[model samples]
Target: MVAPRDNWVVDGLGATHEFDRLHAVEHRHHHDGGGGELHARGRTIRDVADVLCAAPLDPRIVAAIRACHALGCDLRILSDANRFFIDAVLDHHGLRGYFSEVTTSLSRVDADGRLRIAPYHDFHAGTHGCCLGTCPRNMCKGQALDRIRASTAAATGGKKQRLIYLGDGRGDYCPSLRLEREDLMMPRKGFPVWNLI
Candidate 1:
């Protein structure tokens, strides 16, 4: 799954080294309600988005998206990022309608416009038996890909469809392994997944 674009979060925030530090803490403490400290810092989700969402959309990616949509490629987004952030980016570029599906961490804006995000699978409330060592505990992209394939099969009367997965992270490795012989995996060059392969 693709997290919020790096340009919006990391570099845009001028905190290149802070992402791992921040994300690691969040992942570990999320189930334990350890995020109270972060909120106590007076930095709400809205505040972050207000700054990061101002990054200009990449034209090359936008052109590619339009081309794929025009060709009826059945586009979808599988992202680790929350919907609020993804929607904000998509809405900024008027590209929200281009995708048939967007699978991500669920999010909603509270009455006060604070973004509340939840894991796609509640890792704390119930058991999620991934059995694979490669994925984040909150959600497994391989399982998610399997579900997407099942859904598409149901939609198309059980016809087999080839898939093309493009990703750039260690969490993405699980889904890459799920690809069949006929499917394609495009790992961004020099990224962790590519290095791993």
Candidate 2:
């Protein structure tokens, strides 16, 4: 069955919408210990990961990814989603090998098996200078795009590859600004990013 637009599953805690596994675990951890109205209901991050791994990928998207790889295109995934979810989805769909690089939020499970999520570029540390001030505190996709472009150019003997960005979120706006006139931005129609652009 097709999941909801937000990909949320209704649990005993009523309507809880978690975008990724890390957030789901964090939510459960917050209420699990309090004996409150909302609890984990014995679900862990591992369970969330398993569900995400089993989630199906669109065959069209997988075919497009394979076609890009076959054509010698350097495929990169820059997502605000946590590493666990992104990696799990890609690996599960057998699309991990197509990506030249994957950048995502840092995540780790503690000794107690509680998941911890951190910003890729620590906002408290003043790591990024996003003039728009619209991106998330966890990461500035524009800065990450700059770094990726520079690194790609350096590795490819100073020739910058053309960028074709496909995004559907508000965070994608900043990076869309970074793209050159020659590059293409494929923002999902009716999404915040499309409206912003």
Candidate 3:
């Protein structure tokens, strides 16, 4: 399943609900909690990173990703996961160089190697101005896609293009609404976003 990167990485897939408790307090008080992601087993950052790195990566998915890059597609990641986790996962799977840019909602890792996630939009400051209620408080995938499209157009000297999105979460639904007639929206079967469509 495609994990939601907005609030956290995954729900049941090795995600640490322990960090959620900390995040809740931090989010409520609008302050830093000085904590990064934690494993469900209460392991530290290094241990979790090691475990996640050792996790099995499906070969079929990796090949598909490789094929897309081989086709000269400009792959970009718009993940809610922190840069550290995303980079670690991609690098471990030998898929880091396939993407051109990663528009992730995360701050840099601390010197101590803790992965501190920054909101895509600062919830404490103001709203993301999105009417789509499906969007998470940390980020709006639709707005981010618009920015990416604008940048792509600018880079191509205003040339038009199409998009093919493959996603399976509530946040992914907002971006599907932004797709044009020529764009493809491939929501994973039985996911919340698929049912929403």
Candidate 4:
């Protein structure tokens, strides 16, 4: 995760960083509920699209994504970020063609015009067996990685592909543990995962 900079301010999307523009939404309503319930009014998908389109993409990363796609690599994104934001970013950068799959939090606009965000997997429903409690209740990246591996193998006629994980947050640590010796992990050098490793 990027360290909090002096210029960083909390946006309506509840993000404190400048680069995370995907979470920026019009916060016209707010709510506090027990047991992971959120009652905040949400912006529409169209609103999110506007914010994401205006967000800048790193040219280097865009080039890299294109190169990976040209090589026929099976690119996937596993993120705790909301799907709307992730999708918008990919579309904005013209990098959507590079990724075969993207796993992220589910986002939707409710009838009351509230943006509802929910986890892809609810741990409260049942544990994912992550020995480390570092991950949030919404997801366990380790488990997601296992499922991805299984599906990838199944899709490729039981031939396992070499895995490469790139992440920066503490949530990434659990998934890193699941990687085999042949796999590669690229954690941001100064981020929590890299420091922990």
Q: Pick the candidate with the highest TM-score.
A: 3
lDDT of 2 by residue, 1-197 (tens): 11211233223223254323445566433212221221245556666566676566678988898998999988898976666667767777787788878887776666656556666777557746787866766778888889999998899899858999998878899999999988999988998898998
Provide the overall lDDT of each model, using Cα atoms, as 2-decimal numbers.
0.71, 0.67, 0.70, 0.64
What is candidate 2's CA lDDT for residue 82?
65
lDDT of 3 by residue, 1-197 (tens): 14224233333334546546656765531113233443224545665456557655678878989999999888888754556667778877888898888876676656666546677888779988889788777779999999999999999999988888888878889999998899999998998889999
**Candidate that would win on lDDT:** 1
Q: Which stretches of candidate 1 lie over 4 Å from their true place?
A: 1-39, 55-57
lDDT tens readout by residue for model 4, 1-197: 12121112124334334223322442211111111122232435465456556554567877887888899888898876656567667776667767889887676667765546667676447765677976655678888889999999999999879998988888889999999999999998898889878
lDDT score for candidate 2 against the true structure: 0.67
Report how far off residue 123 is in candidate 4 (Å).
Answer: 4.0
Segments in model 3 whose C-alpha atoms lie over 4 Å from true places: 1-17, 20-43, 54-56
Q: Which scores better on lDDT, 1 or 3?
A: 1
On the 0 to 100 scale, the lDDT of residue 143 in model 3 is: 92
- On a 0 to 1 TM-score scale, where does candidate 3 land against the true structure? 0.82
Q: What's the CA error at residue 34 for candidate 1, in Å?
A: 8.6
**Of candidates 4 and 1, the better by TM-score:** 1
TM-score: the better of candidates 1 and 3: 3
- In model 3, the worst 10-residue window by lDDT is 28-37
